[model samples]
Target: MRRAPRIRLLLWHASAAIPVLGAAAAFYGPALERAGGAWPAPLDDVYIHFGFARAAALGHPFSWIPGNGYSSGGTSLTYPLALAPGYLLGFRGAWLGLFAALLACAALLDLCRSLRRLLEPRGGPGAASSRWVAWVAPLFVVAVPLLDWSWFSGMEVALLGAVLGRALVAVRRAELAPPARRPAEQLRAGLLAALLVATRPEAIALSAPLAVAVAHAAGSLGAAASLARASLPTALLLGAHAAANRAFTGEWSAAGAVRKLLLSNPYPTPLEKAVEVIKNLAALRVQALESALGGPWLSLVLPLLGAVAALDRRSRRVAVPLLLGAYGALLLVALNATARYQNLRYAAPSLVMLLVAAALGAHALARRGRLAAGVAAALAVAALAAPSAGFARQIDHFARASANIAGQHVEVARRLAARAPRPRRVLLGDAGAIPYLSGIPAIDGLGLGGYRGMPFARASVHGVPAVVELIERLDPAERPDVFALYPSWWGGLADVFGRRVDAVKIEDNVMCAADEKVIYEADWSALAPPGERRAGVIDEVDIADLMDERAHGYAFPSPRAGWVIGAVLPGGGDGAPRFDAGRLIPEGREQSFTVGAAAAFARGPAVLALRTDGGGPIALGVAALRDAGGEARVEVPERPAGRWSEIRVPLRDVAPGDRIRIRSLLGTFRSFHVWLLRP
Candidate 1:
């Protein structure tokens, strides 16, 4: 009898595995066929994990590129670590995606089995419900096309789902256990919580409810003791992750969050930020409900339906946690701007949580009567099986998207890799596929890969000119040899600083940022001072170049507080730097520059010569060091509107260590260059 139950249980799992794996195979087959038998993943982001996994396998864990050092680009720290083993087993290149697919399929299978156990009741009129749930629940969760879509996308969504499923199982086990056994059950829940967070930080919401459910089952003392033990593992893991991120990236959060989150972007006011967040949250909630793959809108209330089972106190323990966790997961993705992008991959965890709660509701309704059972089964099937109605369309989309990546990013990378003398360093905006396939050191223009420093992240948010300023600050040797970027994305930068060496244009572009990408040989000669040094010019500062400003002891509080370097101003064919009211800060601005001793005691008293655009009048204030009370002021009147002109601020007895402060008194102004000249 025991063997028969075991065999029957094995049969149920096998049944779930067949459809799940078969669906994955179906997705992969079309993708491979579309890519001309090449190993291709549906998204460029997939190769990011592959690159990190390759580095980990080669003993450089957390490094985006082997020699690039530690990077926080991998969103799921544990995921690439998990895939690293496959790299050791020779699953390199496109085959690594296959390995990921197989792993995700197994996770889905485990999720199905867990859901079956969670929905199966022990006795009463509900006993018959268990028999049907054994087959229906597993089939339902596995059959959702979006789940299949996410799993085969070669991302961490499935692993997160599996961890959540196991956490639910552990929660249920703790709820039923006697006080003595609760400790061990809680330990399992705690460790799973750690794993859950490691898979995706937002999963902490799901993990928190498990602890609450466990505590609700036992009394205060048992709950406190169990939770104390449970909290240890998660706390330590989080501490270690924080330490590593702080050490390498100077941040407590991953680089992905820094680059992608709307909260991380520059905002003018706190109120505006709050408004945007609320707006995004509302939009995401609607999108999540409407998405066929996210399941029926009915899921929003299914947990309440499941509350009917709470008449049994033990059942109430199960119902409360599932309900909270589902909504918590929803809130997690709803707050993120990128969650709905990339075919809704980030929202998959929330969708899975909703379905799990809905399954509970169906089980509860099935126990009431035959009519209720039939109706409940229909709802369950609609929640799960209805998603498959679009599976064929999803498969077609996967194939075409994979082909798109392979033809564009992969092709460009391979060509570069096969060069006679491989380029020393390549810069890329789309940092995923190219870096992984080419095996070249890359400077990710977007800072998603190995590009170091918060300056890059901050500059990227401000736009091309700010990015150019950051690049100007880099040492010459650190600059890239070639740039691979979409003309549509970085046209100004490329046109100003690079010579086009080659280009690639694709037909019917869908997944790429643009239809055409150009490769350029870096040519920064134009960045040098335009003409010969003028006579009597003792010292000068290229005000637009951030590095030059820094070298001349330029000081301003605005940029740090959200003022941005303006767009590249084409002043009579010159790339002049200026400041504008970017996202938040006001147009009015002020800056201070130190006049060197060489210029202070030149042939005679110095004159501050400023090459500027006559936007408005500016006030110039001069004071010598240690002579604060004695200061001089000069007013500069506006000139022609569209052209560059020179303005002079005459000074007397301006000895060494004197300072010059320029303030825009009326409207915005642009200073191309500032010079300390002898009269």
Candidate 2:
């Protein structure tokens, strides 16, 4: 390859990568603008990477120990690895953006080079055919939807592609060389293979065939030596990382274990593990095949053609490594299939191999002559162009979503910062992105109240006493001033902080921002137990009694419209009735219930009141309550049947001062059940 052509190749590579770069910028650049100070979901990894890389740039060790101030222990190492180079270059967000662009460009360039090598050997008519194939190969590779999506994420797909491509080129070069000149060539091959291994752990599997190829090229004994030498650097790097992880987590394989836990736990039975592995493999196969075939049919066709081409004697060497990489990817996919996010990152190496195979197939077709080459080039270009178009649309959607999310995060961080006192611990339901954005020390909700020796063993040793001790040990000064709970975990916090003090700031559903610092001014002097602290719901509920009186009922009005009702009462006298539902129903609607004639209702006689939407006012009504020898019989009413209607039965009518269970057979009701108790 001459310098002029090489420069042209570089320029061509730049041109091919420009669209992807533009797409990434379109999707992620706006994210930076709207981020206020918060990062996006997939970018959680990126933010962690940024923190670690920033620390590294400032001459600090890249560790995940949070007490040290710049820890990424809870985060994956992918971001750190991807962002470290950019940070070292003194680049902030700009460097990250550029690094992403360059990795993509490198993938494109590798594709071009691989195509050129595969095509040139067929003794084509002129440079024009080779040039066409070279350019078209990358264009097709980039057009794959999977590759396009991978670019949007803060993953190293581009780098992975480059590494795999370089490994292939080195392998091909070593294989085709004379036997006498092979040893030195094999060393170079080993070095490239090592680089691949260092890029991603799964790359070892992806590059396995190439390792085998290098071994074969060197003869069995020489191959073993060559393989060991190639893997030495990777072994050392991983060994050091493992040692560090052991020091931190008390587990030599913490990195892998953490990754497994984060991705999917495979520690159950072998059958379960096998099922998970298969599912992931199937997904990767589908995605890879879909990308190669253009959309669906084309994806199948192109790969089949490539496979057919690989059947030729000259193509087997190339085919073997591609097959090995693909297999490795499938294995990884099976191991990590449940984790959709991680799957995308893990698929990078395999996609690189498929792109290589596709290029080779295109090259073989183009070998037939100008017209043949033109047709193949056109088909390849079309395959590439179509995905790029879809990828552009996805980038647009991702950009808008990311920007909106980022803006919301910034607002949340700013609000929390404003409300919180200095040096106060913030217990964030979602510690991710918030801590980095707000510049506050946040405690993990997952580790709240300390580990209590394993969940199952908490009651046997200390019971409520243990819980009380834990609460007492928790310093309010050290407790988070602002408790930010993501919508998913808001209920858990709500259980901890009672209603009067906990206020929800809802923009999105269930995402609540509560001020832990808010002190309620209650008339404690007038209480039955004067000066006694108010208890949370858990404290109020007598667990044994509550469990004993629990009744669950579910009704499906239609296939789509269904309702579930659950009631629990504390034992001894009548505890306050509680209702749990999948979703909250709006108030001021007629609610109906289907009471089976044979089924028992409330344990004791009860009073009921229909509370309003916000539990403000109560509507009083009546329902037939029969005492059936410890099994209460409640009959479905005729008036409120099949529609929304409210019926509240007083405690005096049923069992005096006892809680009753009621639910909507049809239509909506307020979020509460009938709580009949001594008032």
Candidate 3:
């Protein structure tokens, strides 16, 4: 029946859409939901972007909240625009998901368009010949290592690819069109080129080949002028972005110029600096190639094939832009390797050129039949295997680990919020969920202009000095209630806060400590009597004495006479200790040494004491022992002075019946000075 044929067509269309839908689901489903689920940490830029999007939704464009900070240099306005519709539809996750979906759709469409051109016969070639060539052409384009790289992150590469494809089509159409209509075609070509530029600044390099191809195909200067006019919109957009940068940062260029200036040292000659820049760019190109292909071999081989294919008469015109764009990318990579942070996404604008070249090559090779099939199969396997391996490895590590770490930060923020009074300012070094979940303003320690300045100003009011003095005034009572200092900045804080008063262990060896002078009521009352007490009535002495009495011995021990050691073994597979002697030893080398037992100390009254010199400053406290009588370990009551050279204890402090043992916690100490003390 006629109905059967229409039903078949509908089914075919639905089947074609299945891949796009599946890809969208894969990219958006779990990934977008988990995007901002984690708190502040390294590589948490996704969350930062999500937070910015949320802020934008709340009528606070360009304003960053506590946990999330402002975009420092270049902001991605495209992401917000892409997400705005989904956000309005009441599916905030759809903001990121929809963008990813659109990108996938664009990529698929671009591939189909490129394939169609490669399949079109030249010089009256038959349909069968064109089909044979086009089948492999699609495979070659899809199998490129660069395309695989785009899958890791949802980026503008797909959109750029689609635009380039459209431009290439327009260029081809203009060449075959009538002279009177050529001008209109050129204008359309230019407009497409301009759109590509608007989407990505890097597309300017691609535009060069487009302009030349359009002009050559149009066959007249007047037609080229009309085409140039069509490109004005893209020029205006670029000009506006530059102007905005100048207005905000007082620089004509983007913030990247400032970064370049700061990162580059003053050279003796311009030539020398230029040479250095070239070297750096080359290194980045090498890295980009390796990232795309999984190794150097594929990087060299695929691009060579592309070049060869572009040289063919039917493909040479399209190949020109592809080659130029590829070279431009190499130049960009060599000059700014660090900018490859986006990996393939950064190299994506040029991908259309590369794909076009590959498709042409595939078409030319298909004339050789079996050879083309072999090459296509090999390229497909390589592309699929490499990306699959990379994705599997990444998922194995990031899927669970990222979630757990993010959850930990969320819990930490919650605890801090419950303990702190309402409306209290919390000064956190690494801004995480503390600002959002804790309902407190968060500040970044890196000093990039946010609420971070407020806490630093508050701390300075209490006579505390800070690195950046962004604010002028602060109330003493309004000082930072908590100081979340990461280990990296721990040493730096000594100069700012005078001393570290208390410490709490957090994830990744993160230590959240506070200054003794800046006391919190929650901390104070935890040590006070069970009955209610007025915070204002407690004088400095009452607080200080309570702190001193309750303070445990040194949280960690300092090394003096001996080094701390672990996991040492003798050559014969016997367990022993290894000592450090200010020199490097070959792996698996065996050595022995002894430490004197003259300076061990105890905190409470005991009849037995053991002496050893291996525990670093942190080991000064009581540590749990397996053979000891009690489950809890007692710490030294007094704080050590001058880096804790040795532990000293009176003979009577150790109990007679308790088994005493001493061992180094971290350094290399082969032997211990064992001794028992009696009253």
| Top of the candidates by TM-score | 1
Task: Name the TM-score of candidate 2.
Answer: 0.60
lDDT score for candidate 2 against the true structure = 0.47
Task: Show where candidate 2 strays beyond 4 Å.
Answer: 1-14, 17-42, 64-82, 88-131, 176-188, 219-221, 255-294, 305-309, 312-318, 341-346, 368-375, 385-389, 423-432, 442-483, 487-494, 497-679
For all predicted structures, in order, the TM-scores are: 0.83, 0.60, 0.55
Which candidate tops lDDT? 1
Tens digit of per-residue lDDT, candidate 2, span 1-679: 4899779868766766665455555555655564444333334344444555555555654542133332324333444556667767755542454555555555556655655566555443534564566655556555565555565555556666666677777777787768777766776777777677555666667555676766765653476776764555556666876786545433454333333432323124557667766766666666555643356666654555457347645666676678667767657555653334432546656666766776676666666668877776766765555455455545554454444434444455556556634435555432344555566665544421112111111211112221222222334444344555543333423233323333334232211232222211111111112122222211111111111112222221221222222222222122333222222333222222323223334444343433322222333223433433332222333342222233444333343222233434333443323333322
- How far in Å is the alpha carbon of 300 misplaced in model 1? 5.8
Question: lDDT by residue for model 3 over 554-673, one digit each (tens)?
Answer: 111121222212111121112222211111112222211111122244333432232223333322222223224432332433333222122443332342223233333333322211
lDDT of 3 at 617: 31
Query: What total of clashing residue pairs does each candidate reach?
Result: 0, 16, 30
lDDT of 1 at 334: 57
lDDT of each: 0.69, 0.47, 0.43
lDDT of model 3 at position 625:
35
lDDT-superior candidate, 1 or 2: 1
